[model samples]
Target chain A: MKFTCDTKELSRACNTVSRAAATKASIPALEGIKIDIKGKEVRLCGYNLELGITTMLESKGDSEEDGSVVLDAKMLCNIVKKLPNALTTIQADKKSTVTIKSGDSEFQLVYIPADKFPELPKIDEKSAISIPQAVFKEMIQQTIFAVADDAAKPIYTGALFKVEDGGLTMVGVDGYRLAKCHESIDYHGQPFDCVVPKKALLEISSLLDESGDKAVDISIGLRHAAFMIGNYEIFTRLLEGEFLDYEGAIPKSHATEIKVDVRTLVESVNRVALVVSEHLRSPIKMHVGNGQIGLSCATSIGAASDTLDANISGDDLLIGFNHKYLSDALRNAGCDEVRLQLNGPLSPMVVLPNSGDSFVFLVLPVRLKAG
Target chain B: MKFTCDTKELSRACNTVSRAAATKASIPALEGIKIDIKGKEVRLCGYNLELGITTMLESKGDSEEDGSVVLDAKMLCNIVKKLPNALTTIQADKKSTVTIKSGDSEFQLVYIPADKFPELPKIDEKSAISIPQAVFKEMIQQTIFAVADDAAKPIYTGALFKVEDGGLTMVGVDGYRLAKCHESIDYHGQPFDCVVPKKALLEISSLLDESGDKAVDISIGLRHAAFMIGNYEIFTRLLEGEFLDYEGAIPKSHATEIKVDVRTLVESVNRVALVVSEHLRSPIKMHVGNGQIGLSCATSIGAASDTLDANISGDDLLIGFNHKYLSDALRNAGCDEVRLQLNGPLSPMVVLPNSGDSFVFLVLPVRLKAG
Candidate 1:
């Protein structure tokens, strides 16, 4: 096989696909990226059973070679990344040895037979629905960070993707906190619900930023999902487990309420968190009363307290929390002001944007020991 | 202790000193930064037995109160880092409770009594010698990276600082490589040779960058050396040992000579080094002849080769080396062209800048097994 392509184009494609390649897979072929060429078109694919990513591009150098080869993903990607910004030509023999030539640099890398490479899961195109990339990316960001990182809690390992009529809602929960976000789309397909692994959503969000005005085409199957954005096609196996009733977990009524600037609250909590971080429990306390909220934290290392201006008109109460949980929700609120509703000192509090977009963030207060 | 200062200035001082604070020192007081105040002058000091860094700053906000307090270095630094970019006032009571106020944000922190703070070493001004900051920084960079990191080889843990007749020579040697750099300065003190620990030199270089045209004042005592640069003062206990005879390690004659572009050699060697990195012992082979030099490396993972144009007039021969040693020396050569002198395949090779500067870098070659 012989093909020539633009250095930058090849470099970008290699980087995108290599993210899915397994570094310590039991099967050696899983460590290689399969390159297939047909009629001046080249497709690079990487898969590790759980997740797969592929990108298709034209040869640019006008080569019409038709063949396939699997080369070490890291070796090929690093070479392309360092190659001079010029046209690059790659040639491989029947023995599966590939040579990459660009400017005055030439690299020879051994490869595994393409026949042993795993095939990406097939997508059911008839059930595909397209959503604006901006809205989809925003929804993912507002909820993904709340997902639990512990593998033992498999039910909370992924975000729930529930689509109905023309609206999509994503929910992420880790018992301590829950984030639910909704975005309207122009879709009329049959409603579906699936849990997607957090790792796949993170990779998708990273590549979606460059889509500009483009829309992402998503198709959901019984046990798999596929997302196509720009020239990249990403497929992943859905997380199979029962999801929690997040709606029931959120408190509906509150005795105390406060409307505060998101940026102000984030900064104050961040500073107080620094003091509390000395202790692993991270006890940052907030007292909502009068026209301001007092944020404070005290540990064996030191103590810090700060007051931020806010609009308050409910019962006066004090609540303690893991500062990280509160700061993260405020920063991701994506609005100038946010409304915080608290039922009591021990109840879960809800934070929502003041502009009336459909986003609900709930955080359970950490129980403080009596001083 | 009471002091008012610009938030940014205080933040910079705190960060510089925090680098020396111990994270888990047996003495808890070592984890704190001692803040001493006199009139409008403020000094921030952090020391962990082995190294000490202190910076003096004029209080941007005038405060006549004078006393001292010791606060958790990391906590205070983090709080100041996030504080509003405005004038900040820090006041401490005799009970060691401190209050920091800036704009709408106020923080209260507990501190340790200043009496527990370690005393800084005193420097004798009569034995002090000054060197241009830029020249000293360059000398450190040229030789420091060659120092051995193994504590077992204590003799190679620091650079030998040799001064005579206003000429300064710093030498660093690991078992496999040696680097010597010389800089001429205006000094008339008694000649002295001391080994300065690597950690101290690194911290000194970081602060010297901002010392534009100023000179660094260096004072060496029996067991300690201090460097004062602009607003920062750094002190450290010297490494007590006999330095290796680096001059005897360099060969005086060679059978081959090649003058090559530094950038080209660096890029080619860097790329070939990637292919051979899978093996512990790097074996990048260079064959010099006619008008070009061919660099290549081969391992079970892959093989890479590139040819760079060079000015060669000596015997055509091949030599192998751990490309890292060569690439690092070339990267630090600080010249457009570099000349390589080789004795044989098994002998050490010397690399020098083509512009005839006082720099000598030597790297021993790796032995190749029979093919």
Candidate 2:
């Protein structure tokens, strides 16, 4: 394979696809990026069986022939990035030795035969949905943090995407907390739901453009899903299992409600958490009063207490919670103020926007020991 | 103990001393910072037996009594940094429980008795020298990288400071390479030599102001060294051993000399080193000719080569060196151009300034295998 391309473009493409390359694999070819040259077009692909990323760019120089080779992913990326910002040429000879030249520097590396590389799984475009890239990115960022990393239940490792009644809702739930976000879209097909692995969603989010209204087309297939963003295509396997009924698990009513500034509450929680270390895994205790919420934590090392003014309209109550869960929800609320709803000391606390119902975060409370 | 102080000043003082606090120590008090209050003066100290750092600041509030307490170093720094930028008051009750309050936040922590903290070693000022903080900082930065980290030979783990003939020289040498820097100082004191631990030099370097010509007083004693900068005092135990005779090891003559741009050579060396990883510990080979130097490296993974123009005088030669040692000296040369003198393929290569003799860097050659 012989082709010349801009060094910056090649470096970016290599970086974009290398996220899916297997770091350690039984198949040696799976740890490499396959480069294919046909006339003036060049395509680079990286795959690790479960996920694959492919990108294409036009070469700046004339190609000697149409051929392909697989090079080590990490080495290729590093070499291209460090090369001077000029036109770079890559050529592979019949002996399976590739030569890369730019400016006054040259590198010769042994390449794996292209025939040994595994092909990406074929994705059938059964149902397609198009949404603004920024909107989709926000939805993922707001909900993906609650996904469980445990492997015992595969479904909880991914976020559930549900499309119904011209609305798209994404839900991520671990055993301790649940995060859900919704956005309106123009759709007329039958309702559908699918679970996408967290890894794929994070990569897609990073590649999305936040300012422009560019659209990303997502197509769900029988066992795989494909996401098309500009000239790049990402394919990921659909996680197989039944997801939890998050709506049924969340509390429907609350006996106590408190309206408070999100930033104030988040800062108070962070301060209290300073004394809670790995050795002292203490829970933060909140005592809700008539006009303020007192946040405190006591461990063998130290004790910290903070107070924030809140508009409360229910019976006073005391609750205990894992500081990390509470802080995560407040930080992701993406609003100035929020309403916290509590049914009892042991029930889950629901957090919602002060005026709208676009997002809902539920955190299960930890039971406190008797004094 | 009771006093109020500016939060920013308190935080900065805590951070300044916490560097010497031990992360894990057999003595519990060594992991904490000692705070002593007398009248309106507040002093903070952190010592780990080998090194000690102390700083003093004036408190804002009137003191009720004079007392001292030791608080956890990490917790104190974190709390002060995160607290609101306002006046903060700290008070310890009769039960040795300390309460820290600022704005609407309060923290209560148990403190260790100040009597348990170890005292800093006394330094009898037998000889003293003062130099500009900026110049001293630069001298340390240029030579400290060559200090050996191996504990087997404790002498090589510190830098040798020699004061003689109205000049001060700092030398750092490992088995592979040596770095020496010299500066003329206005001093009339007995000539002396001492080895300061690399940890102490690093901390002193960081605390020195870079833009001013302010002087830092350094006193060398029989068993300890003291560095006084502004209101902070740092005391460190001297390493007792015979240092290497660096001047005798450096070559006085060379068969070949080449003048080259420091930036260009550094860039080329960096590019070639990319292919030499931990698994492929290959040395870079340089071939000098009439007007240019060619650098190349080959391992099982790949081969890279580059050429740079230079002014060569004397016989043509070939040499090999570990890329890391070569690059470190070149990058810290602090000049645009450098002169490289080589005796033969097996002798040490000396890197000198193009115009002056203020600095010298020597790197030993690695023997290459015969083809």
Candidate 3:
């Protein structure tokens, strides 16, 4: 079959779809991306049994014939991207050798039989929920870093996504710290909650339309969820097992409330953490006074202390926490002003943006040594 | 001892001097950077026995006393950078704990006795030569990448620097390729050649001011060479061995001459190398025709061919070369139009800028199997 396509368009499709292709898998078919040509359109699909990505591209030339073949995704994408950005023509033979030519460059790539390719499972679109690209991408970015990478607790590696009555909440936790992002969406369906693999959410966010004007349609099934953007659809498996009750874990009341600049806190913790982390105990201590909060860390190697101007109105308290946890929470607070609510030195600290009550991050403080 | 310094200036001095400090070395003193405080200037020095770096910073406040101590370089730099950029006061007690306070942040860094630090060797500047920073930096960038990284041949790991007859030449080579960069300098001293370690040259290049207006004073001794740029000086041990006769190795004539665009050839070779590298024999073949040169690489996995427009004269020749060698030579050729001179398939190919005779890069071609 002989067909031609725009070089830029083809390159983008190959790159986005290739992310789901299996690498170093035993099955040769799983390593190839299936490309099908019909009339003036070409459809490329990449599936590794668990995850699948499909993208459609409009060919710039008339198709002499219709055909299908599975070609190595990496080589094809590399060749296309390096070729001059001009009209590209790809012609495949019955012998499973695909010839790709653009400008003065030509590549003859061998392919796997198309029959060995796995088919993407279909999701019912009738009950699909639509989400604005910006809303969904931001939610994933705010919570994905908190997901656990440990295999010992597989349930904690996935984020719990819940949508009900125009409200959407994404929760991620690794026991040490929990990140929850609540945003309003245009949804009127029954309340449904699903645990999505963190890897899938990250990949989807990378492909999300950055303009935020586009809407991503999501169809959730019993075992799989499909996210459809402009000309592509990604299917990811739903993680099994019950999720944690993160809402109940958040502290309900606090005796101390201190408001400080988010940027200053992040920078201070990052600096003091350098010296603090060099010792046996990697904890940065926070002491609240009348109108200021002091952050200090002392080790055998070095000692650092930083005082930040804050509005503190509660009993003086001294607390110790892992510097990394505090830094991450402060960075993700996403507002100029951040509120730190504390019950005591032993309890978890609730952090929230000064302007928003919808989003909150809870961090468990490291226990201090008793005298 | 007590002194105050500009936060940014101190941070820069610490970072530049820290490049030569040892990390986790068997000798604990090598991991520390020595700071010497005098009347109104502070000197920071980091030495790893083979290499040494020294930087001076001006004190903002009058010094109450003079002292010297060695501290961890990375921690000191991190603290200085993260602290608020304002006037910073640093004071050290007899116990060797140095207190550094800037704005609202304070750090007390433990230090080792300054007597344990090695003294930087003095360089005689009477017979020293000066070179433009731009010319020296550019020469390093062009040839440093070709330096051998294999420890088996320690001599090839450094670029031979020669100053004679008003010509400054730097040569770097591996077994497969050699890069030579030459420029005119205002040096009329006795002819001398020394091998400067690639690492030392790279570090010196990083600290050189980009404006090119500043002159870098260089002093070469029997065993070490010193490069002084502004308030910073770097000294590195010279490699002891007879350098290779690279000037004699370059071909004086050629059987085929191919003039091609540097960028196009680089991109073409990069793309075709992907497919070529996937096979057992990773070599790209170049064929010179009348008005065009074809580049092709085929393996068991795939095949790619690209033809670029070139002005080819002399007998047509077919040659094979390692893609990396060819790409490196092309990238360092600098000029947009590059001339490729080939004597035979087994002979080394000389690549030069179409208009300049001062610069040359020689690439050894891989012998091809007889057809």
Better of 1 and 2 by TM-score: 2
Interface CA RMSD, all predictions = 1.7, 0.8, 1.1
lDDT of 3 by residue, A193-270 (tens): 888888788789998876748999889888889999878899988888888898799988899998888998888888
Residue A354 local lDDT, model 2 = 98
Comparison by DockQ, 2 against 3, better one: 2
Error of 1 at B345 (Å): 1.8
lDDT (10s digit) by residue, model 1, range B150-215: 767786888899888878999988888989999887877788888988888899988886457789
Sorting all predicted structures by lDDT, with the top scorer first, yields: 2, 1, 3
Arrange candidates by TM-score, descending.
2, 3, 1
DockQ of each: 0.66, 0.87, 0.83
lDDT of 2 by residue, A162-249 (tens): 9886989999998899999999988779898999999989889888888899999999998899999999999999998999998898
Chain B TM-score of candidate 1 stands at: 0.95
The fraction of correct interface contacts reproduced by each prediction comes to: 0.75, 0.86, 0.97
Which 10-residue span in candidate 3 chain B carries the lowest summed lDDT? B119-128
Q: Where does candidate 3 stray beyond 4 Å?
A: A124-126, B124-127
Model 1's TM-score against the true structure:
0.95
Q: Give candidates' CA RMSD values in order.
A: 2.2, 1.3, 2.0
Worst 10 residues of 2 chain A by lDDT: A57-66
In lDDT terms, which candidate is top? 2
Q: Per-prediction TM-score, please?
A: 0.95, 0.98, 0.96
